[model samples]
Target: SQQGEEDPQALSIQEGENATMNCSYKTSINNLQWYRQNSGRGLVHLILIRSNEREKHSGRLRVTLDTSKKSSSLLITASRAADTASYFCATSGPGYSTLTFGKGTMLLVSP
Candidate 1:
């Protein structure tokens, strides 16, 4: 099973600041996605970038994928205390429906 690794295991920022996290994977994939999880809850899909796509955006979130480097990055602009959560990147391999998730980056936003 292929898995992704997220950098800066933890992050802390003030409200209205921006938060960025990176994910690196080992295998070829069809699509890569980012998800956010609040404490003690399930994950909510944030955005997805295909192997052929270099960048994508959703609301205040920005996602970039570099298939050549087998890596992706997620950015959240104007972060809020409500945005404090763990962010994870998941990748689905070719012909595989299962997605393997990264360790996750915990973001803390101060009010």
Candidate 2:
């Protein structure tokens, strides 16, 4: 598949701790985007780092991309209970309007 799969289907962490998730893809991509979805809600864009970029950070979130390995990782620092959600990595086709997503990593941050 051209899409990526995240390791560890689920992750649990305490408030104020850090959480990390990794994604592996089979094909080259233009860019990779990380999104967070609250329970039964729409996904909120977290960050986008292109194939040419190595690392990017947003607020308490950090993302790293390794195009040569066709993989990426997302790190959430000092996570809070509100951060509990499903995280997905998305990449779009050059002309397609749809984005392909992996099964996603479920994160639960307990207070």
lDDT per model, in order? 0.93, 0.89
RMSD of each: 1.0, 1.6
lDDT per residue, candidate 2, 21-106, as tens digits? 99988877888888899998999999988888999999999999999988999999999999999999987655544677888999
Instruction: Single out the weakest 10-residue window by summed lDDT for candidate 2.
Output: 91-100
Give the TM-scores of the predictions, in the order they appear.
Answer: 0.96, 0.93
Candidate 1 ranges with C-alpha deviation above 4 Å: none
lDDT of 1 by residue, 4-109 (tens): 9998899999999999999999989999999999999999998989898999999999999998898999999999999999999999989857999888999999
- The backbone clash count of each candidate, in order, is 0, 0
lDDT of 1 at 32: 96
* RMSD of candidate 1 to true structure, Å: 1.0
User: Candidate 2 — which pairs collide?
Assistant: none
Alpha carbon deviation, residue 88, candidate 2 (Å): 0.3
Backbone clash total for model 2 is 0
Global fold similarity of model 2 (TM-score): 0.93
Candidate 1, which ten residues in sequence have the lowest lDDT sum?
1-10
